[model samples]
Target: MSPLRLVIRLTAVAAVAVLVAACGGAQDPDVARVATGLLDAVDSGDGAGACALLAPPVRTELEDTSGSPCAEAVLEEDVGAPSDTTEVEVFDTMARAVVGSETLFLSRFDGRWLVVAAACDPVAGKPYDCAVGMP
Candidate 1:
């Protein structure tokens, strides 16, 4: 093969690789949808709706709390709105979202995604455990 032709081929390959890397590594939209639903539920003060969107363990915990002040505290926070800039990491049937200062970990169960855990702080207050609320 001619040296010039080889160079052209290599450049084309490199360009294609860059384009794929840039456009193909996007996070799944379903994950974002789950995150948005959870956030909206919380912001709207829909504890039942939020609980419905929680994984089993977290739902159980929330239920056992029996309407504690912890729930109110979570509902009161100005955690900010969901944004397109949120980061998501997806696993087999689970995902985590980092939106602003809050981090929500979720799971896909029975064909729906539900939040399992949410925490704004690592050391303070009751971290909203969504798994505890599942009935």
Candidate 2:
């Protein structure tokens, strides 16, 4: 095949792959569940439960920054108790959940969803400012 035709075919395949991945993410209920579960745990003061829902890196970051275990350190953060999850959008292994006024980012690991970032607020023309993890 000509180089131009090969490039076009590859581009089309990539687009289709992205669309399929996005659709699959949208339909995954576990993403929403994990996001809300974290919020619920926080609201109920279940530090251990909340920490369990966090991604390993995020948990490590919290523990390292606070010089405490994740269970204790997670509770100390200003992660708000958002009563309702308004929206959840997943893209492949990554996810974004909007719970009340706060935004959370998550990732899927071993078929389990885990929160990678929480207490995020959007900054115009910039990445989110998160109370925990990357934006």
Candidate 3:
């Protein structure tokens, strides 16, 4: 009704939208599958398998940062095991999987979901800080 009330209403709607966007699940099942597969490989110490799940940019960063093949470098990261995955949020081509105490970020390319970052922690009002693929 009033200008101030209109502004407040708009802000409330925006906040709800953001929350809904951040907490989705299952509708993007491929994202969850790829994310879980990666953590499974890491949990089993299958370095090559883990590497296979990484997005191209992440793979390149791993190789470039470690001066070794991504297959080997992926093993060196300290991402936690996959006890459970929840809060599988998908925003267009990007997705995030909350795996135990960490989060994994994924990207889609040509219909494939690939891990772009793992062991990520969110900072309030800021981008995530990650142990892998942080650029």
Candidate 4:
């Protein structure tokens, strides 16, 4: 093959590899499972279920809002499931997931992986209070 053609082919192959890696082509099964379960719980409006999957700090925050109006509103909204193509990154004791424009950070606590924080922009219809409270 001509040098230019060879270069083009190599570039195409490299691009595909990068895309696969970015999407976690061979993600750890356990991590994938946890991430999926958490998202499913949140999507289903299972606040208690979702709370169970949160780290101590985050869970405490949620529990603190026992009689808050925000909590009631969140329970009523019934936020739908995240997009199908959520991305998860797993580390030894920490993981980050990107669902749409929001990013969730999780940490392994005790014997389970639980979400600790979520990123959101207030101006974008997602206030910090809502993100921290809901997620």
Q: Who wins the lDDT comparison?
A: 2
Q: Which stretches of candidate 4 lie over 4 Å from their true place?
A: 1-26, 65-80, 122-130, 133-135
- Which digits, one per residue and each the tens of the lDDT, describe model 2 over residues 10-128? 99999999888768677677777888888888888899999989998899888888899888888888777766546878787888888788788999878888999998888999999
lDDT tens digits, residue span 8-35, model 3: 9999999998887766533788887888
**Top candidate by TM-score:** 2
Candidate order (lDDT): 2, 3, 1, 4
Candidate 2: stretches off by over 4 Å: 1-20
Pairs of residues clashing in candidate 4: none
Local distance difference test, candidate 4: 0.59
Angstrom error at residue 43, model 2 = 1.3
lDDT of 3 at 67: 95
lDDT of each: 0.65, 0.84, 0.83, 0.59
For residue 106, model 3's alpha carbon misses the true position, in angstroms, by 0.9
Q: Is candidate 1 or candidate 4 better by TM-score?
A: 1
Give the residue spans of candidate 3 off by over 4 A. Answer: 1-26
Name the lDDT of candidate 1.
Answer: 0.65
- Candidate 4: C-alpha RMSD to true structure equals 8.2
Clashes of 3: 0
For candidate 1, what is the total of clashing residue pairs? 16
The TM-score measured for candidate 4 stands at 0.55
TM-score of each: 0.58, 0.81, 0.75, 0.55
